[model samples]
Target: MAVPAGVAAVVREMQDRLDAMPGDSPLRDFLSTYQRTTTAVGQAITDGVFADGEWVEEWDVVFAQLYVRAYDAHIDGGHVPRPWRIAFDAPADLPSLRKVLLGINAHVNYDLPQALLGVISDADFADPVLLGKRKRDHEAIDGVLASRVAAEDDELTATGGKSLVDRVLQPLNRVSSKRFLREARQKVWHNTHELQVARLAGPAPYDVRLGELELLSAAKVADLLAPGQVLLRLAVAGFGVVLPPAA
Candidate 1:
């Protein structure tokens, strides 16, 4: 499939997948939530929510294409990144929340840095004024995501039937979601710089660093599959994976 041209195209692509997926398909867990989030972000852009709406729109499109490519690759029996492979290969019986978290872990932790690199050139990184503007716009996304937590929780509960424990923990989950997203994005900015430096060095160095990110992201996703409260485990262990020092 052609890469989505804008946020609206991205939402439509996701919605098409959702419509095609069976109710019990594990992939639906993430796609449905992601579709909703993308719609919200699109609306925010239309509402002039960011200082640089055009930049945010470009970044959003680039960010989403990574996930879309991975999903398409998996479906086409092609090479899938280790992080996404873990998320996609997860058993169907896994909780919807866990499945969604798996997708989030893979996409946010693994795909985000590369996406940042896609939009922010090395020269842009060197310009403090430009970089600050980019960073501010990046953080603006946190507000959009934060606002969706309670509603997303309700959607998840409505579709999958949350346990009583989960129902009681709704407020905590909302707070934790916001916190982790912010933390993850912060790391994404740092990791993007690391990747940018590697890119400046050469394609070989960039590839090696990206491979390391893929491994670390996959490991984090695997950890989430283990027994424990997902949010609490994320809180204790922290969200987003870090890049190893440049070789």
Candidate 2:
């Protein structure tokens, strides 16, 4: 699905916060990495949302689909999705766009494989170490998602229905998350693991995975840049289209 506009605002807000951090901020590098990620994803969205002189409303959807298909299907033995969450009626300046991008990226990585089960092969699905990571990540991520769902539910209960999370974190919310996790385990992780067992598991598919990693890393660096010139550079490099350069 296409990312929500709320996500764009979320990233912009986080971009400002990251800017306020001191040069000496201990987590500056980590933040910078994410910043680049935000920028790239934002740019990708921009490309999709405003592509070829028209508003292609479902750009994020196409992009995410392509990404999942491209996934190596060999990460720690399974795919892990990273989905985004946005708060509504957020403070104007803090749009929280960055986090949303991260979330979608997460969801794609974690949740989007079985949907393309035909494209990937069974011989590629079996690896023990990798399979283990898939399980652990699911176990851990399940908690995070449950927390959000529960928190949203609790919010409504406490507010007598005043909370967005509470209202929206309904049955559909939990079902999708569980469904994605189950599919990834059965189709990508377990299948890959089985492949590992049937034949000799080879060295890691580092090159392909690294390329995908770099795409995300570049996005992180691009997101934290100042408004004028840097933003233009990012746009041109990422989208192949130009806007007025920073004044």
Candidate 3:
């Protein structure tokens, strides 16, 4: 299916704004990566990469709407999704990459599963063949993610000069980034299934499960920004100090 018009407009607006920002700005870097991923997903939908390309396009729009809400909230000093609250609340001095990762964590871990259900019907879950096809398509985005991240690495390194810590993380990131995406995507599937099960049980159970997912994401973000991790975050911030600003 073609990319939804609404999704296209949202992405275009984001890309335009990101284009207008200073290249070295943390928000610009975050939105640059986000825009590239959205563009890839849009192309994938147009190319019929998913068996249910229409559903995939709808899911992309639903997922992006949540980000738009969070971003607007951040700008207007209004409420945001709890996980995104952490990202917006992060210290201004935090490393640019970490800022981007916080947004990724909130969006993927917190918002993706909820968005998944919005795209597929409860009946769609019953067809094993169809389910498998949708899942395969969902999982295939890992390639898109890997490519986008690899291409963005130079910009990240330029923004924050690599440190010993970054070097140590390099081999691990190369090995584990796709693995991480796969695991995260799998968890989203599982969460969607669990919510479906809970819905059959009762509203109370469904609500509780949803709350648990939100709490889990909040705790994960807390760990990411926890005091124990401060030194590493600060180190990355310091890495950029000696480097000249982006042109």
- List the global CA lDDT of all models: 0.87, 0.35, 0.70
Q: Per-residue lDDT tens digits of candidate 1, residues 1-247?
A: 2222498888888888778778777798888889888888888888888998888889888898899999999989999999999999998888788888999999999999998899998789899999999999899999999998889889889876466677788888778888898899999888998899899999999999999999999999999899868887787778888886786
Candidate 3 clashing pairs, residues 3+ apart or interchain = none
Worst 10 residues of 2 by lDDT: 81-90
Q: lDDT per residue, candidate 2, 165-189, as tens digits?
A: 4245445534543444343334334
Error of 1 at 191 (Å): 0.4
The number of clashing residue pairs in each candidate reads 0, 42, 0
Q: Estimate the TM-score of every prediction.
A: 0.95, 0.27, 0.80
- TM-score-superior candidate, 1 or 3: 1
TM-score of 1: 0.95
lDDT of 3 by residue, 45-129 (tens): 7786677767777888888888877877877889877888887678767666667667777888888877877776778888898
Q: Candidate 2 local accuracy as lDDT?
A: 0.35
Off by over 4 Å in 1: 1-5
Best by TM-score: 1
